[model samples]
Target chain A: MSLDIDAVKNIAHLARIDVSEKDLETYTKDLSNILDMVDQMNAVDVTGVEPLSNALDATQRLRADVVTETNKREALQANAPATEDGVFLVPRVIE
Target chain B: MYSNWETVIGLEIHAQLSTNSKLFSGSSIAYGAEPNTQANEVDLALPGTLPVLNKEVMNLAARLGIALNATINKRSVFERKNYFYPDLPKGYQTSQLELPIVEHGELFISVNGEEKRIGVTRAHLEEDAGKSIHGAAEGCTGIDLNRAGTPLLEIVSEPELSSAAEAVAYMKKLHSLVQYIGICDGNMQEGSFRCDANVSVRPKGQEELGTRAEIKNINSFRFVEKAINYEIERQIDLIEDGGEVVQETRLYDAEKNETRSMRSKEEANDYRYFPCPDLLPVVIDDSFIDAVRGDMPELPDAKKARFVSDFGLSDEDAAQLTNSRPMADYFEAVVADGVEAKMAANWCNGELSAWLNKEEKDVAESPVSAAMLAGMCKRIADNTISNKIAKEVFEGMWNGEGDADAVIDAKGLKQITDTGAIEAMIDEIIANNAGQVEQYRAGKEKVFGFFVGQVMKATQGKANPAQVNQILKQKLAG
Candidate 1:
């Protein structure tokens, strides 16, 4: 239920976030407090109560299978940092 | 490849649902569209956008589960599979993890005439990430998000497959079943249907499973078999060399027909799956399952059984006819179009199949229609053309000459059934082949075929074979 400095660093790396060495201890303490609060909430006993996925007590709304969207590549790609031939460009990722 | 070793393989097959729109968004899911043209805002995972379930996707998934006799989870939850990839714009993939939509299904695969039951662990609904086109740009990867949010049914098989051939048989059976039920298009080259194999090997009598290496994204059936074979051999070699098999992901290179480690995604196991808060738990009822079941076409097994019982076809012929929906329908249509059951089955499974294989075409793509074939078979039934001449007529029909009657008339292929004319021709053939006829009359019974062949040659293979046989026997006795 607690986060250590190395665990925090690993999480930061997985999320692709940069954390200065000085801030690691502080981030660890903050994340540990958040986990503690989550652990405290988990202690509540409600065996018969249903877990709610959304705030509204409703099942997922079903949509008819139909395409309503048209080509708007220009507008959608307007905010992209880099694009080429109507595709978003990023650093080369090889598998 | 070792006799003392046993290979255990499990398959994860992803079948893209044939829908007009993306799984959760209203974007089009058509293949080969211009890059990003169909990437709607919801598929891009824009802030404040929520996903809604496509009713058709659920119906198809449920249809598959019903066909497989799987338990449909009434309340299935969607979870987010967290990962980092250029093609995944949401930073996580919306997939079913803990509460998959279907579970505990089983399918049978036949290898070497022995049926093996393969258990389906579960099937889940998931959204596909976009395409990352490598080498599309200089020093960069180009991402096309049109495929993002596309619906996929990830069917996971239990690790019971013992060899590459068995794995392939299982895959083919599943492939035909999905296409039979109209759930997937099953186009491997286009990525509509893809498979991954988890392979491991152990000593023959050992019970505990060895570490498995997952070969990923094999798109073709051939590639699947080759990849599994290569991986098995690799594992056996590694073990024999006193090395250990690492449980990691590997990629199959079709060019080299080999598999290599893809170490980049080895940590892909740590997906940290959690409930996707945006999509609510989908609840279902018996009525939903019933509706899906009603719309499902007859499965391959049921159709094969019907072919056997109703048409009196042999087990092998029935199986061949029902290998695909279109082929089964084609066979039935031939029978319904006035050809007898056994004749229809013969032409369908024999000559028609040979022509289709030679032309590298599906039964659906055959130039000769079912009705056309039925018409041709009727000629043989009525003694208008012998089966030998019918092949020539069939070839003519396949060449687009016309229907059976037209081809028969054009090629002068009508069977010679007149008793007097055949007798005269037999007399002439006996006159020509005097030595052979003497040998036949002197108790050389096999020379009778020579006389029949000569008579047939004179008639240009148009003589009815039964009449030829009877007359040759009668005339040779004298």
Candidate 2:
């Protein structure tokens, strides 16, 4: 599938990236090339084969349901850019 | 005026699993904790943090699959649904995309005595995002990551429901089922169980589906019904006014009882979904499935049938009793303690239920124990106390008066079956009410109630009503 400027701009907006007019042409070409390369797998005529979702065919390893971790609010919140009263603060989000 | 439109509804229910820890992290999953106290490094998406799948989530999901009679996929994959929200610490939700864990399930709901089968498309495991507390900080949003990484089983239903009532019934049945299987707590108030309803209206007997709108995060069953109804009417009104229903996500303002568009389709976020690379495919062997099935409790439908045939309860009573697992357990406990099934069912569904409703308590939180109720039922059955006196005793018990016998003794509410005492009262009533006695003997049969009432009043209402009637009838005839 071919990528247009508007489509690229929409994708950039969804990804929360700011795309300028000068970069739009480059982004469209790059995204289209990526899609085309990924679409190359469609050339195989394996209609009945099940699609693979994971690279490793291994089953998922399960952990016990116990609460092995303790409260680390102070340590975890140390990485936040902004925090107040044990909450990570952000710009006001309106519904 | 709009008889040409038909409402079609389907529901997607997100039930938080009742596990102790988060789905993919070791963080504690307890609710109502101090803000951010439950968030660990893994939940915070710190560098080098990896997610480990909890085994209990699989067991719980398998239990739900068995309960719904769904086909359990042996292998299921976890995918990353990418979205930008302040609540999502990882910037993507780990959910099952194309291959859900359970699929092709069906639930039967009765709407106005018409039974319809609602098809369950799939039930997939996903991680919940954190909470964004608005209006808490001055012109800012505060995020609590306590709910982040929590497990949710999103059960999606097919577009089979035709009305608001049907959709509500379908939701109630699914809610009860998940709670019954012990997979979810089914607490809508705390949002452990919430639903998003997809509703659309079309011309009657039309084959093509119309554009649908989704009502999001409706937490109550009543709101589900009301929101669907309001949306249906809105769509019909729009179509009749030469407008088309726009596909969008709407928010149900429960206080106002109306649905307003949250965002139109063009502004909808594209949740670019792809399989997660961190986690492998979840594979279940036959033995694991068998163990989960073996550990399953009796489901609601089976319990309802057993209640009908084993206890000779009416279908309505049985259905009511088995709607919740705890209620069914309470009823069975009362009967197990030697209370007659029919009488026990009556007291449980009647007086006990009424008292519970008044106190706004669930069966599990009932103040009166099953043994206490059985004791009261025994008194009523053996003529120790009349049903009316038992109600008064129940009230006393609820007020912490004591057990049945203590309440009866403290209140002097026992039935008086003494024939000699009843005879004395009857003779006095006959002598004093000479005019009424003459009226009764002259063939005014209704006056018999007057003498019985007087006898009862004289005995302070302790007289056994049947014994009072017999003795009073004999004295009046002679």
Candidate 3:
């Protein structure tokens, strides 16, 4: 089964997207097509095959544990929506 | 009937690896740093940034896995757990889902001197989230990203624990192991080592389990025990009143000693886990594992065994001496100073331990250094100070007088082990206490004690007790 409009709306809400009602139908149709492709891909049975974590045959690089990062507060926090007392401020979230 | 209910407990401990830098970023992992100062482009989750794993984290994880007798998977993958929170600048946390570094380990815990084995389900590497300082602003929370991207190994345990005491034992054992292996600091106050407990109750002999409530962020061992017991009793009482316990995340109110439902965290959605495309899988070869094993420090159990066999110490004394690395080092240093092994163990496990317990200080913070203690213990071993005189010398040393020889010389507390001096003192006592001597000759054997006391008192209580006793015995017999 493909995704429905209501399901798409709930997902958009969870993602904090401003999906208008008109766009909801389009997103539902578009998402359904993507799910249909995924379903087709899942049809192949590979029970004993190990799951692939990466496409590359190489492993990850390891870095020495050292303080290479310096205080770039002025440059980094320049992109934040709000900051004060050297911290990014947001609506209080308890727990 | 209520007592028959079986409680199952499993703990998830998040131990921050004692690395110099963050897990994926080169940002300093030092605590109490000024917020965003430590956050670099990678830690800030900026676009077009990639992550490189810290080699120390893997080595520490391998050390812990080997210490716990866990299997180290050759290949482990990191996944992104999608969630939204202000403190988490990135919309997802990179964690291990399917393949973790360590798996299927077991550790032993002693509860009331009875050891029990608890299974370690798995331990995975993950980055820590930033701290959310609530009410720091008007109707808002201030986020400190200093702790963000810090390396943490989340250790999950099997639900085999039955009681709160057993749960505490398991937590303590894990804590000591992490600290002993030098992977974690085991500092709960600083949030280095944190615990979360999954507790549930079921009817006796029931094959199925009741719904579990997860108590999150229990920072202290005592708090873990208290919180688990409270949750268990609450579940039992709720079921007894025909209520069903729902699966939820609970917050421990340490001030009230209760676990309350955190409906907000519960409302959070499911974490969609997918392998991170930005980072490749971690593949540890045999050489890497061997290197980690070689770097592993001696664990507590092995140290304890060595102390017993090498030093001929009793099991209890060995346990007490090797309870911590610093204490064990002190014990060894004292013995290395030519003190008898038994005497050093006695002084270390007896006097030093009692003093530490009373003053509430760790051996690392002891005012007496190992060399200083060894100096004092040397005097007792060589009979420079008798056992009784050594106490006075120790008191002087504790009061900052000096080391054993200094204190003994400064206070004139050195034992008079000279046989000739002791004989002269005994003769003087016999002549002065003629009546007591007569009583001793007339079969009043207790009079011998009076003469010995006179000798000790005449010497200002510094007479070698053994020598004094022998001389008094010979004089009284004559």
The list of candidate 1 runs beyond 4 A from truth reads none
lDDT (tens digit, per residue) of candidate 1 on B1-478: 4988999999999999989999999999999999999988899989999898899999999988988889999999999999889899999999998889999999999999999899999999999999999978898999999999999999999999999999999999999999998889988878999999999999999999999998999988888889999998999999999999998888999999999988765446678888998888898899988888888889999999998998788999999989988889999999898888888888888999999999889887899999999999989999999888899999999999999999999888999999999999998877777888788878888887778778888998998889999998888887
Q: What proportion of the true contacts does each candidate reproduce?
A: 0.91, 0.88, 0.94
DockQ pick, better of 1 and 2? 2
> Each prediction's DockQ?
0.82, 0.83, 0.79
Pairs that clash in candidate 2: none
RMSD of candidate 1 to the truth, in angstroms, is 1.7
Model 1 C-alpha lDDT per residue in residues A1-95, reported as the tens digit of each score: 39888889888877789999999988999999999999999999989998776677888889999999999999989999999989999999875
Q: After TM-score superposition, what is the CA distance of residue B379 in candidate 2 from its true location, in Å?
A: 1.8
Quote the chain B TM-score of every prediction: 0.97, 0.98, 0.93
User: Which pairs of residues have clashing backbones in candidate 1?
Assistant: none
Poorest lDDT segment (10 consecutive residues) of candidate 3 chain B: B263-272
DockQ: which candidate is best? 2
lDDT of each: 0.91, 0.91, 0.88
Task: Give model 3's docking category.
Answer: medium
**In model 3, which runs have C-alpha deviations exceeding 4 angstroms?**
A4-6, B265-269, B395-399, B420-460
Of 1 and 3, the candidate ahead on DockQ is 1
